[model samples]
Target: MFKSFNIRKKIYYLSDTIKRKNVSNHLKEINFILNNPESNKSKIIQKSNLNNILNHATNTTPFYKKFRNFDSILDFPVIKKLVIQDNFNEFQSYPHKDKNNFKVSTSGSTGVPFFLFQDEVKRNRNKADVLHFLKRSNYEVGHRLFYLGVRLNQKFSLKSLIQNVSLIDISKLTDKAIEDFLEKVAKDKNSNKILLGHVSAFETILKYLDRKNKDITNIKLNSIITNSEHLSVETKTKLENYFNTPALSRYSSEEAGIIAHQTIDSPDTFVVNHASYYIEVLNLNNNTPVKPGEIGRIVLTDLFNYAMPLIRYDTGDIAKTKVCDNGSIQFESVEGRKMDLVYDTQGNVLSSYVFNKIIYKHYKKIKQYQFIQQDKKEYEIKLNLQEDKFPFEKELISEVKEDFGKDANVNITYVNEIPPLASGKRRKVINNYNKNNSLINPALSKHESIT
Candidate 1:
């Protein structure tokens, strides 16, 4: 009576006996966050969980031993990746959960990786959250999921395979690979199919498919989940139309498995995973949480990760938290990390997405554009254009200066091409002034060939 996977469902059982290894009660928790988050029962559950997590942290971890069980969770300091790494030993809880413990690291956004440990509960919760969202996009447990990546290191996953996930390395994606993937899609018509990939990887696939005039109408994709890079409106629409399915941008990180993700109706807004995490939006100046409309740090307190407790951990990303009339929590216009954040002359953080917003309109004329902050109040926009003439130069300069403050110096550099990194991804914005900005690469030139 031993089986590798769980798929059976019985009618009269009190509990679903046939359950997967990673399955948990997290589905109920996730639904509470997504649906009845403001209900009294939900509030009590959150309060109880928070208190328990805090007590566990205080009792077990060396870093939180200073704060007694009765101390407020807010009393704990907001931590970054650097802080954890410097005090790595202190964050670890006692009794270790040694057998079930596993190490996970943040490797994508910043080149420098920060390691943390998570027990089975945390891992199961992560899996459950992902499954919940996948279900929203019409994806089922046994559905075929294709994950495309840029310069992928690990090509295989046992858990992913168990969940029927096929990893397709799109680093140097060949015509044969595209054809093979599509052929599989064509073959599997009865079952639901999913594509989880980087925005760039999807773009490459779309371009290749378009070149060959590939008809994907019969491919029957259940959903397309784009991750890693930002999925622009144009990209999302194209993918959705081609596959005749929903294109959802998943807001996730290695530190926190599933932070937030786009819903079917509203592509822009992300529904925060408040079930597994207690999300706080804190302003740049003081550590206080900002108003719903204002931009601030997307701080998190993992409700489950007692193995390596992350209390008030600043994710370095900026977003506006919106509380709707429906009593649901949502994150809007979520931008890049703190390292890439734009700052005014007075060291006040401004929205770094200004450059991208301004340049997006002229994407046809301009092949690629990058906004670079060379020094304090000194910025340069490197433009790789399709045509020799650009009429918006002066207007764009003035607009950018206004956003950066009165003291901002803005200049435009026309280039033949904006060079891509070794991984073949181009950064839209960068801040070279701050050494703390982990994404900075001084050796990287603004342009491949100056015009």
Candidate 2:
């Protein structure tokens, strides 16, 4: 039966199964920890693993050698993206055995691209962790997955061609593009399909479908998983309404594989993958654990990445934490990356999510967008577009004027590309108003005149 389907996909699935089995022991240990949340044995195992990784990093990795005398984990310095970027080579444990390691690059969304290597074992473990979480959504090994995210520029190998996966580049999303992708998915009647992609990408597709009045009721999906950005209630509800399936959100990064996943029982709350990662919610002012319910910076310690162990790695996102009745820790809500709110003429603070939804809703030709708040009432909109001109620019401006009032000054500029931050992360909205404000204000109306 498998042979009748795509042979390359079948072969890839079989090979993936074998690789997953290779890390069966690690999976079993993780499962054990998940099952026995109250058991001291899990903590003992976790501590042992952390100690082993730390010992290895201290002895072999040049970056961590200075911390050999660190008696407590807290005493160890919290490393940021720049630290890794500056000392790339020092992070590797066995640089001479490059054959045993695979190179992985960060998305550079923060404007700093980080290149790191992972041993084959750590890579397999990451895959295993992903598989375990997928099972929560009733996803099986043979299920067909439609991934909508960043498109890799590399040529697809025979293995990739055979895999039960379809890719749609999120950067090129438009009304016609989304319609064609959905039409293709609608053809596969018997396959159990799963939709996975960045949250914003999913929102873009949903908006396009809504505008075109496309019906997706006949195209049944097992689940919809969103990642890469903060998943808003509005977005999740929209997805669930359109697809008629549970829309789950996942918190993960290129640097650290699966961090947390929304469970079937609670689609809104994220349960941490405590076995693979030790998560900490620290005070933004001082790097110490914040009390439960207080929003703080999310720091993570990867238990399995021996090639480049990330201890107390600040993830640059903020979230409140809670201890459930089962003694498990969960994220109450993710506030997204720390960004200043854009202000209107009346001093009304507008969330970045609000602008994101509005821009994508009004303009179908926009491939990418960024909003820079020049002042309280002045703003600049930078766009990377799929077409030469935005047909709905007038309507979009009207809508913005309605929300922001007529006193607002808006400038729209089309660009070939919007650069990511030094940390390799792209911010949708940037607030420069407060940063530019000084004690002695300029007497010239305190605002730049817009032509």
Number of the top-ranking candidate, with lDDT as the measure:
1
lDDT of 1: 0.74
Error of 1 at 263 (Å): 2.2
Candidate 1 lDDT over 1-451, as tens digits, reads 1122234112101132244443546776777656777888888888887888888888898988877744576667777788888888898998674657888976545555678999878887897788778777667666677778666656565555556667777766678888887787688644667888877777667767666888878887777898877777777887988888889999888777889888765567888877788888876555777888888778889998879988878787778888877777788767767678877767766667767666766655666688988878889999877678999988888878777777788989998976655445667788887644433221212211100
In angstroms, the error of model 2 at 203 is 2.1
- In model 2, the Cα lDDT at residue 217 comes to 86
Worst 10 residues of 2 by lDDT: 442-451
TM-score of each: 0.81, 0.78
- Candidate 2 lDDT over 1-451, as tens digits, reads 4433355445655676776646556667777876666689988987887787777778878878977976757656666788887887787777435566778887565446677777777787787788778878767655777887676444655544454666777666767788788888888654677888877677678767766788888888989998777777877888899989999988887778888889677688887888888788876556667898887778888877888887778776677888889888888877665434466778665555667667756455776688888887887888888677777777777777777768888889889987644332357777777457631121222111111
- Cα lDDT, all candidates: 0.74, 0.73
Give RMSD (Å) of candidate 1 vs. truth.
7.5
Please report how far candidate 2 places residue 429 from its true position, in Å. 2.3
Q: What is the C-alpha RMSD of each candidate to the true structure, in Å?
A: 7.5, 7.6
